[model samples]
Target: MKMRFLAHFVALILFPCWFVSVRAEEIKSPQPCDFKALFNFGDSNSDTGCMASAFYPEILPYGETFFHEPVGRASDGRLIIDFIAQHLGFPFLSAYIDSIGTSYRHGANFAAGSSTIMRQNRTVFQGGTPFTFEIQVAQFNQFKNRTAKFFNQEKENSFTKDIPRPEDYAKAIYTFDIGQNDIAAVISQSGMEYSHAVISEIVDNFTSQVQYLHELGARTFWIHNTGPIGCLPVAMPVHNAKNQSLVAGYLDLNGCVNYQNDMAREFNKKLKNTVVKLRSHYPDASLIYVDMFSAKYELISNANKEGFVDPSKICCGYHENGHHVYCSNRAIINGKEIVPGSCDDPSKYISWDGVHYTEAANYWIANRIVNGSFSDPPLSIAQSCHA
Candidate 1:
């Protein structure tokens, strides 16, 4: 396993150059940014293992595609965060909550599965994790302060390589990939009356959080807007067609609920505006807002062209008869025996389970956005630093 990881590490270091195209002018980075670390904040989309570590560990087939074992990720393999780490020539960011063997030299991830931007009126047992975006930020503050304290102590010298240097904080990449669950939760509970006020509040909370991170020394911001939730199989199952009458006329050709997509777009619009506002307020900060909706929607709408199969069909778990048995769980659904499973070809599928994307799909999205194709300033991830 060490040999395999070493090979990957060497490959990344050898091939670290990426071209940054600026308005028909292609500029090559002599080398990637001297980004010493990365501090991430988000939900399941970028979760390394926070939720699983704090809760139950994901079983086999969760990390089967890449790790050959469950490493507590909610996917079949690597996530966009993983690709981001690989691209930046850093080891994967360890979850802040997962203390076992976690080395945070490159930075720490505060994301957790099903985390929301604001506190919901439910428990972790209901759906999302208890750590809201605000809580994650608080955790980041604690991690930073505590690590600083440790560094000031003599006996903690052993953590020189496991913790970030004081100067590295300003050079770290702060990536955010949340808001999908918050919006989904709202729409699920409130139906078409999905409160824009709630969406506004979430966006405001997101902006505040980013500003806090910036104040904490994050200079380069890589923010991802919510994806097209309308296309998610988990959002609208075929068995629940009767319940989709509200979106019957709004359904796109590919069967995605356009109204839900519109809501996502609304959220993205507000988010983009907030980014613009932030950039204006903090000119020295590179706040890159990524259009994840277009990146994901394109893949889903044109899956065949991308060597992928059905866009809505999942690579893991079974959803039928208005019942869903998750990837690693088995149950008797509608008188049929359900077993834990996944598709034979995960690389050819868009979604992993009904909720999360497959590793292949994740890689595709990461590849596109990293090049600045979907970014606001059209700056590649390597050139995201304002410094």
Candidate 2:
């Protein structure tokens, strides 16, 4: 009974077509400023080279577009965070595990391919192990420690007599992108059949994860609500399972699992409220919530405006059944094993591999974030991006 109630609630709340009007001007970009460094955290979507170098299935097609060879991104080229850093005048962050000294000084990326914003063993899907939000925060703590040591040594050598200044700390930027994996996990694993108590517990734990980041000097928060999960190649296959003999247009195509999507929306709503509640506790804190769902929807629904075709289909996949073998898989023949083909132009598609966005899509998202379209009224994206 509780499970059914939760499912009904999700269906009602997560449907994107039903939106309330919040009249406001489109947010604008802030006057550009320089930042010494950037740090990112999230799943494969935001991973630059962490997973590509760390994991298997290494192949040319991985980073073939931008690097003309694999550089460890889930996409064919750069990620949104990469663009954000470059836009701000800093070099792209090196992975935390990278051995290069100069890249390490620019900043470090803590993002892993399958990370989540929850502490539980909840996965992004059936067989994926995500570094929980708690784990990601831990990685940040490590980065902070390393940075302090590096800067501390620099100050000692340069100043030889004075204490470290606040300006030194201000030079670095810590950016984050997560929460989608959590919603995806709930949909794929629990499937809206869990008890309300279970759902509530999960939400509670998630809220705590955000609070943890706050305590750790995470001043600038770039939180993204889940995108249209239901519309993805994976979710589309699961949506409307009972509606057989139906045309493709007949499916409930709101982009995400209804209940889980609602969970994401409600999480965003409550998160905004939570941020308000937290301001008193952390006065200097700056938190910005990006409505990734709405942004992606506008891009996809009005593809012509963005000059894109189907945002639904990925650029690379198994020709058969569209079951979606790994994007970098070198061997995928006709229902067998052999080298496959990648699209000539990945930028034309929103999705690069089945599960991640193309460099083009990430660029568009970064533009919206800079433009302030995703920001709450009055505060603005520029204020938050630099906050």
Best by the TM-score measure: 1
The candidate maximizing lDDT is 1
lDDT of 2 by residue, 1-387 (tens): 999999868866896344332212233435543455566777777776666555664576777888788766787888888887777666777766555342554566778777766565433234544466667667777656655664555444533222223343344555667766666666556555663444455456655766776666556665665677655655554322443464544444534345545666665566566656666666676666677777876777766567876666678765334344666565644676755567888888887766778888888887877666776532343356454
Tell me the tens digit of each residue's lDDT in model 1 across 1-387: 999999878866776452222423554453557898999999999999998889888998899899999887888999999998999898988999998998999899999988899786643224667889999999998988888887676665676778987788988889999998887876776554537877888899898988888888878999999999999987665735355445347678877877788879989999999999998899888889899999999899899999999787888887875777889899986697889588898999998998898889999999999988998888889888842
TM-score, every prediction:
0.88, 0.77
Predictions: Cα RMSD each: 11.0, 12.1
In model 1, the Cα lDDT at residue 2 comes to: 100
lDDT of each: 0.85, 0.63
List runs of model 1 lying over 4 Å from the truth.
1-31, 122-127, 153-156, 191-194, 237-248
For model 1 the TM-score comes to: 0.88
